[model samples]
Target: MKAMILAAGLGTRLRPLTLDRPKPLVDVHGRPLIEYNLLLLRRYGIVDVIINLHHQGDALRAALGSGDTLGVRIVYSPEDPLLDTGGAIKNAASLLGDDDFLVLNGDTIIDLPLDALLAAHRARRAAATLVLRHDPEQQRYGLVEIDGEERIRRFLGRPAEVETALVPYMFAGVHVLSSRVLDYMPDPGTTFSITRATYPAMLAADEGLYGFPFAGFWRVIDTAADLARANAILEERPPLHFL
Candidate 1:
């Protein structure tokens, strides 16, 4: 399957570490953070990759040229003015082709079972399946509430209807989306967020947007403290299986 890594963010929270290099290139235990993500995707047999680049985009392109040495074919979707999540994916639509594809946020690290997630997506016949986790601080992030069957009944920390009882779960920065889902997205140049715009729209339309709940090791490197914590975790439990 094809995959897209959203590596174009400014990473303002990363500060000095990102001042010299992009957040994807920031070292998280010896290797660049995005390298670990690429390696994990490679292990899952995702060979074709499209990475969106901005804020030192050229440097990232240079470092990961073609991804040949790493055994994956790399393609770039360079953004002159970086688009948000939905926009980036829409901009890369041609490269992604017309099929179901996986999207990953480059700053997050998670040990997700690809096969299971994909199977769940297919079985539920969902337009998109977001990987989710139970976090009490769901309000802080864009949260989703799933029904017994994992269909997202609520989004963005809001209840969809009167009958729906919201069950709190935070988005895990990973998604399996069908190409048809793009039809609901705004124009490529429009500043839209998949979490904020597309998914909510889908929910309102009664489309089957589900959540794949996974209880695994996951972290998002949004700030210096998060980076340090990821380094500590990697040092304590180096993921050999990922390699």
Candidate 2:
């Protein structure tokens, strides 16, 4: 399987620390943030990894050289004007190729059962399976509503309104997507957020998009406080214990 990590963000939220290094290269428990994701991908037997870079991109490139130490082949998609999530994925389409691949946020730390998520994706025969978790504060972030069969009924903060018994779950910054999803995106654009544009279109078309609910430890490390919490958790005990 192949995968791409969206790492081109400027890390505006993580100031001072990110001023000198990219968010992906920011130290957390002695290892660069992106390194953890690479190791996790290696464990899942996914070696073909593509990462996009912009903020302190050269440092990140130097730090991750060829991913040899991590047992994976790392490829880079260097973007000049930072592209948003949808734009970055669309820009790296050639590297992603013509099949389904895993997409994850470079800064998110989550102990996801990759095999289980993939299995659930295939069973549902979904066009895309979003790794979702039911968070009480789901309103803070973009939410996805899924039915009993796990098919996505609607995406929050979008125009598509569904009257079904929909449970809102926060997107876990991880997904298994078919290349076909790009069909809804423009070839070249300034910036586009996938949640704001693509997923809603898919939902309106009644396309098979499902949520892979995982009640596990997951954190999106964007601010310094998030990094501190992660370090405390990882330093005090092994991450596997929480899993």
Q: Tell me the alpha-carbon RMSD of every candidate.
A: 2.4, 2.6
lDDT of 1 by residue, 1-243 (tens): 899999999999999889989999999889898987798889999999999998999999999999999999999998878789999999999999998999999998888888899999999888999999976544556777888888888775432223335667888899999998899887787768888888888888999999999888888898999899889988898574676
Candidate 2 CA-lDDT value = 0.85
Screening candidate 1 with a backbone cut-off below 3 angstroms (N, C-alpha, C), the clashing residue pairs are none
Compared with the true structure, what per-residue lDDT tens digits does model 2 show for residues 1-243? 899999999899999889999999888888888887888888888999999989899999999899898899999998878879998999898899998999999998888889999998888778999998976655656778878878887777623244335557878889999888989888854578888888888888878899899998777788889899889888776565322
For every model shown, what is its TM-score relative to the native structure? 0.94, 0.92
Off by over 4 Å in 2: 158-166, 241-243
lDDT of 1: 0.88
User: Which candidate achieves the best lDDT against the true structure?
Assistant: 1
The TM-score obtained by model 2 is 0.92
